[model samples]
Target: MHTPTTTPSPVPPTNPAALLRAMFDAAVAAAQPARCLPPHLPAAPAKGRLIVIGAGKASAEMAQVAEAHYRRQGVAVEGLVITRYGHGAPCEHVEIVEASHPVPDNAGLVAAQRLRKRVTGLSADDVVVALISGGGSALLVAPDEGLTLDDKQAVHRALLASGAGIGEMNLVRRHLSALKGGRLAALCHPATVHTLLISDVPGDDPIDIASGPTVADPTTCADALATLARYRIALPDAVMARLRSGAAESVKPGDVRLAGHTCTTVAAPRASLEAAAEVARAAGITPWVLGDDLEGEARAMGTTLAGLARQTARHGHPFAAPCVLLSGGESTVTLPTDAAAAANLGRGGRNVEFLLSLGVALNSEPGVWALAADTDGIDGLEPIAGAVLHPDTLVRAWAAGLNPRTCLDRHDGHGFFQAIGDSVVTGPTLTNVNDFRAILITARP
Candidate 1:
């Protein structure tokens, strides 16, 4: 492992950006497949043509590295993977297609259907390298028969607006998908399916990523229906019927359909968090990782974390101010007001909104700067991953003549942060391991 240079600038027992950055870097490095993919895959099968296929935020990049590794051994493979727009990697052999995410559009529908046909004729000796990641559930949308692309698109819109958790939304997605819930693996059955997964789900469950299209599902149709109901999301008549008809059950694990399968998590949020922690330690600052699989209301989570960070700075309850706090996981945003009904609403993902709320709660405490971002480098539909929040973030917003409360009330963190020039844009990191967060708390130097 390459160690970072340590500058003896005595970090005052209070402020901690350097330490936080180290932990964030470690987490990102841990989830990077460029360092993890080559060794896990078996040699290409002898009797059948190697076929690669997958869908996710990282599928395109995973495919590229997987293909490169095999080709380096003088092996050739042909396949296709669908990734979110602008998430494509440079590919020589495998075809990479970009599509809409969080919702299935015409492009995703076509790409997914095409992927289905590409793997339909595989034989026992053939090998299929399936790359699955966080956004695959929506990106690989092949709704069952009689369901139009619009139908799936409608349900996706509802799910997004519903603030349904990842697990809930994915359960509905698997039921709606023709290629999810092990249907893809079933199609590729008799052909050994080796999956390279970069887990974005809370627990890194293969079945949760992309709705387990290429892995056995542990969720059932009832669970999908219950999730939709729990959120009070109104599904279209056709979608509700599809659920009630009982024809959309996902294949459970231990099913014979997956007798010759393997799903390996080459990377995940935990790996990224640990990686970032190592960076902090090397920087001569202590790192206290809160957790990697945190999930809850974004604003609430922000308040909770901000309190801990403040406590760390003051009481040293969790850790001293000289240490950094890091964590990873997906957070939810429940539409609180009637703003969506009143207007087009604002920009920014859950992470950005969380920071906005946190900044307001922190109230410009000195010597603190924090960054929170989605590792995929895209937050919501925006090209920006997330943003940073310094003690002066709110002050700067006011200086720019922006109303922070109004923005937060309207769920417009992107607009507010952008006005303050705090938005962090790192387009398409070519990987997804959920959200990565670093909070630095330090005393006055």
Candidate 2:
């Protein structure tokens, strides 16, 4: 006699919110370091030490996974990894240090200095595995000569508000950082370096993610200066002088010191999007993955996507009803130009800003619902990830005595969502593959 077997049921299509969240959870789960990093980890060195050094929001988790993978093989490892505050994990072999992210602090400076020292004086027999992911650019803070932590922080603050894309921001950051733009890899000369990356930037450019600490940069100092000028971002006189004098140039590509280094992208935005699409398909919802490298101003992208959703809802030109439109990429929020507005700007990140803008443009369109959140779980500086939108979102805002338009104008997506009790909070997901967005358009009654 054979026992009966049953397949797990797909999420009910009626619960659009739960289904969207499940897709997001599935996407994040797909990029986990435990699942992606081990396959890419290099073999242990036969005669010398296996040193692991890394920095990023996911670095600690990656280090822990790497340590466990090797330990199971009877290979002992020792190293250090730096992660954002509250993102550390317990590990015996690799020391995990917590520091500030999206802005550098004293803790990050000390950690960066120590991390650089750890890789110096290594020989050919030594193997260095760099666990790099998003947020390392700030967590691995090593300012160049004549630059202080305050200077670095100022640059980060300015760039965060400059509406610059990740690639553009990192282009400038590579010049100011001591460990970025492949200098960290240069320091590991003679040692075979294996870099495992979880990409969070569009196009999955290794150099843009975490400013490419272990990857050689092809951009020049002149390019960095051009970016600052394009954004009209001001810096201290000393910082300006450093860039002007070409003193902040990074290690260029093809540098012999960087030879024999290997880089592998363990997880990427495209794979995560595909994972989410699979969930949507299983639920009897047709999934349309728009693309994974979308980029633009947050609100602007929101408006554009709203048009697509409206088109699908009204005419079914692009896709039929009961379908999800999914996309992944980093978006920017250029701060308000007015002084008072800038001073009182409300809390939220690009994902929230995008969602709020989409909700407003949607104008409570029937049978339309959406969710947008950062994969890492923290949107902007706040603990909130992002927000969800329903056909009645604006109606509920009006009922709550909150003006969604005013909130969006002030860049206060968090304020609007929180007041409506619609903010999605998923603190410290420990992995970042940039932003996740899904719009579910059900059949109109």
Candidate 3:
């Protein structure tokens, strides 16, 4: 969708890489806590203690922002937040704890326990302010009763490799944890709960962000069990038994304990994409936002997008060139099932995988440039954000004696991009709005 405006046009950047990076920076900046948090914060309760608790890649930065906001108003606050290691921001009133992400670890387990204890015995006069974002399900690990930390870790590992989408994976996570699925909100019962979220999941559903630790869940243990069965993910016998017996059921919607709880989505993928569109408009490019809730196999999505880009570049069917196609959503990467394929799998996150596949499909189509990156600055588990593609990307790879198809087959996007020095690295951005993809097409002269 075009952002209607009457502002005078500025000179557009001629360099494709510079233009792409500027769009990405705008998207990430729009979702930062300092920019999105204040409007969603509730006023300090007159007769209550403000207790802050949270987890995710952005939770620490969120906590820091919340603390500063309240402190400026002279309100006393106390709490703890757990974020991915290296994603923490300094906070004085709220304690910031670093933990593992995309996978659970002992540190996250300990922090989860502390977080649970903090909310215990909170009176109706107390207020629980929860800062939730993506990656929280793993960063805030508290295995359910009768399940050990090791058991949770084992199930998590299986799920990561299962090719399941975020919705299904979070369903399983919510049922298997002590802190997720409104269980944390239940702990803060009697106290008013306020959940502020930066959504990285499709649909921007509060129930799926960080597996909805503070929001009521409509999914059941049965739903989680079905997801596991569909993905053929084997869990510990104890976990299976709990699910079958519904002993692992999450707090459902309409639960009396959650009566006064409120949830707010402060930032989302759509908003970030809109910000990028504005940047594109200023650059004299027609911006088409393809939607912010796309999901499927990453490589397949990449190939499909490549076709669209080609259509626009060659035929100008979608819109006249000098146009950029933008989209945001989480895409699944099904790890290889074959032993040989698995053994040779390369290092990369889903964004790079998508870009690599797109590059191969385009086969160096002239006047087309693209970038695919995760908004949080880290794609999957890699240190890099994503990669960029130019018309000569494949040509450069071939010149280096690298086979793009072979690399795609082995899931070696990181290797391929790195070999050609095209990987986009931004370290930790401390915010999560999910993936960002943009394809720029210039009119053939």
lDDT of 2 by residue, 51-82 (tens): 99998889989999999999999998999999
Q: State the number of backbone clashes in model 2.
A: 0
Model 3 scores a C-alpha lDDT of 0.90
TM-score versus the correct structure, for each prediction:
0.94, 0.96, 0.97
Q: List ranges where model 1 is wrong by over 4 Å.
A: 1-10, 13-26, 336-344
Candidate 1 C-alpha error for residue 271, in Å: 1.1
As a TM-score, model 1 comes out at 0.94
Q: lDDT tens string, model 1, 294-354?
A: 8888888888888877776667765655666777778888764366544757886888988
Q: Point out the higher-scoring one by TM-score: 1 or 2.
A: 2
lDDT by residue for model 3 over 2-113, one digit each (tens)? 4445332433348978899999999999999999999989989999899999999999999999999999999999999999999989988899999887889999999999
Model 1 clash count equals 13
Candidate 3, residue 284: how far the Cα is off, in Å: 0.4
Off by over 4 Å in 2: 1-12
